[model samples]
Target: MKILVAAAAGMSTSLMVRKMEEYMTANGLVGVVDAVSVAEAKERIRECDVVLVAPQVRFELAGLHQIAEPLRIPVGGIPAPIFAGMKGEEAVRLAQDLIAQAAEPTS
Candidate 1:
């Protein structure tokens, strides 16, 4: 799975990506996680299975959904508490859940 994390300046999300990368390594998950600015995120949404926006920029979720929905990719805002705490595993679990949900047929 590929996950794209977006933030205001695409700066803060790097830490989250690092933590997620560590989690992926530890769990042997072949997933890739990366961070980008909202503009850049728009360009790469198709290359990702899930899109997570930083809490500080959660307001963008609606716009993000507009992009992800048509692509059938899941998009959501990371929970502030967990994101602020830098809970990598928890974030990974959230991404997994999004990917799982996206895989399900929604009639």
Candidate 2:
């Protein structure tokens, strides 16, 4: 899964990206995760399987969904505590769960 991690300015998210990268490598999860600005996230939405927004920027979720829903990309907000703790494994699990939820048939 190609996951796009986004923050307001894209600067602070680098550490989170590194943690996620390390986690993915350690767990043998094959995927490219990119940390980007909200603007860049929108621009690159089409290329990612899932978009994970930083807790600080959770307000942007609605705007992101405007793009993601049409493209069928699963977009969700990272829990603030988990993100602050840099819990990459948990974050990835949350992302995967969002993808799975998106795949389910809605009644």
Candidate 3:
């Protein structure tokens, strides 16, 4: 699966991508990840399994979800600390959990 991290400038998310890559590598998670500016995110969203937006851009959450929902892909914002700290593995785990939850049948 592919994950896309987006932010206003895409600079911070780039660092987050590195952390996530490390976590994925260390944990043997077979997935691809990338970072992009919101403009680029529009084009990249179609290709991703999940879309994580930086907390700094929470204002864009609704619009992003609208686009991603039709694709049946999940979208949400990562906390500031997680993004700033670049905890890549945690991000991957988070995405994995979300996917699992989505696949489950609710009561």
**Descending-lDDT candidate ranking:** 2, 1, 3
> Model 2: number of clashes?
0
Per-residue lDDT of model 1, residues 1-107, tens digit only: 89998887644578889999999999999989888888888889999999999998888889999999988999988999889888989999999999899899989
Best by TM-score: 1
What is the C-alpha lDDT profile of model 3 across 1-107, one tens digit per residue?
78888788656777788888888888788888887777788788889888888888878889888888777778878877777777776778788876666567669
Q: Best lDDT goes to which candidate?
A: 2
Superposition error at 94 for model 3 (Å): 1.6
Task: Report how far residue 106 has shifted in candidate 2, in Å.
Answer: 2.5
Tens-digit lDDT string for candidate 2 (1-107) = 99999897555588888888899999999998898888899999999999999998899999999999988899999999988999998889988899999999989
Runs in model 3 deviating more than 4 A are 105-107
Comparison by TM-score, 1 against 2, better one: 1
lDDT of 1: 0.89
Q: Comparing 2 and 3 by TM-score, which wins? A: 2
Candidate scoring better on lDDT of 1 and 3: 1
